[model samples]
Target: MPIIELRTEIKASKEIVFDLSRSIDLHKISTEHTNETAIAGKTSGLIGIDESVTWRAKHFGIYQLLTSKITEFERPNLFVDEMVKGAFKGFRHEHHFEDLNGGTLMTDYFDYESPFGILGKLADKLFLLKYMTDLLAERNRIVKDFAETDKWKKIVA
Candidate 1:
């Protein structure tokens, strides 16, 4: 398994950051390069506890579908989503938010394992890890841009 931990400081309230992080609409916008879309289940707005979303996206010149279910939720504090069905052997993403001097400190914990055993490990080491990390960084950049500006209202309101 490969684990990725990322932290971003956003100049916004924890509530705003938390909600924006789970917004399907915002995700679509952030991943426009990949042509990501929510194809089923909670396709819009904030995803709450136990809700699942099926996403279709183009990655590495290939189209893939992934479904994830929110397994844990604690409002503006924390949430966890795990893969229900996807191309991976297993995957889990945890989002955490905390108020820090009037701003929000957002953290992401991403864990994933690819299929095909040894070949998967090689792929991860060769390029998949960097690719996934870049995707997450891009997503966070979009979240930060929205949270620090008025653009968030368009998605969250």
Candidate 2:
């Protein structure tokens, strides 16, 4: 398994960052390169505890479907989404937010295990980890953009 941890400081309230982080609409915008879309379950809006979403995305030149459910959620604080079905063996993404200097410190703890045993390990060591990290970093950048400006109003209420 490989883990990607990122801490992003947004000059915005925790509530704003938290909600923006869970916005499906914002996700689609940030991942336009991957053509990611929520095709089932909670397709739009802020996803909450017990909510699931099926995402269809183009990754590595192939389209894949991944279903993830929010297993944990605390308003304006923390949330955890775990994969129900996907290309990987499994994955868990935990989003945490806290107040800092009148702003919010958003952290992502993403852990994932790929399929195919040794081949998967090789992939992680080769390019998968960095690829995943870059993907998350770009997503976070978009979240920061929305949180720091008036853009959030369009996606988060």
Work out how many backbone clashes candidate 2 has.
Answer: 0
Stretches of candidate 1 off by over 4 Å are none
Kindly list the per-residue Cα lDDT of model 2 for residues 1-157, writing each as its tens digit. Answer: 8989999999999999999999889999999999998999999998899999999999999999999999999998999999999999999999999999999999999999999999999999999999999999999999999999999888876
TM per prediction: 0.98, 0.98
lDDT of 1 by residue, 32-147 (tens): 99999999999999999999999999998999999999999999899999999999999999999999988999999999999999999999999999999999999999999999
What Cα-based lDDT does every candidate model obtain?
0.96, 0.95
Clashing residue pairs in candidate 1 (N, C-alpha, C atoms within 3 angstroms):
none
* Clash numbers, per candidate: 0, 0
- The predictions' CA RMSDs to the true structure, in order, are 0.6, 0.6
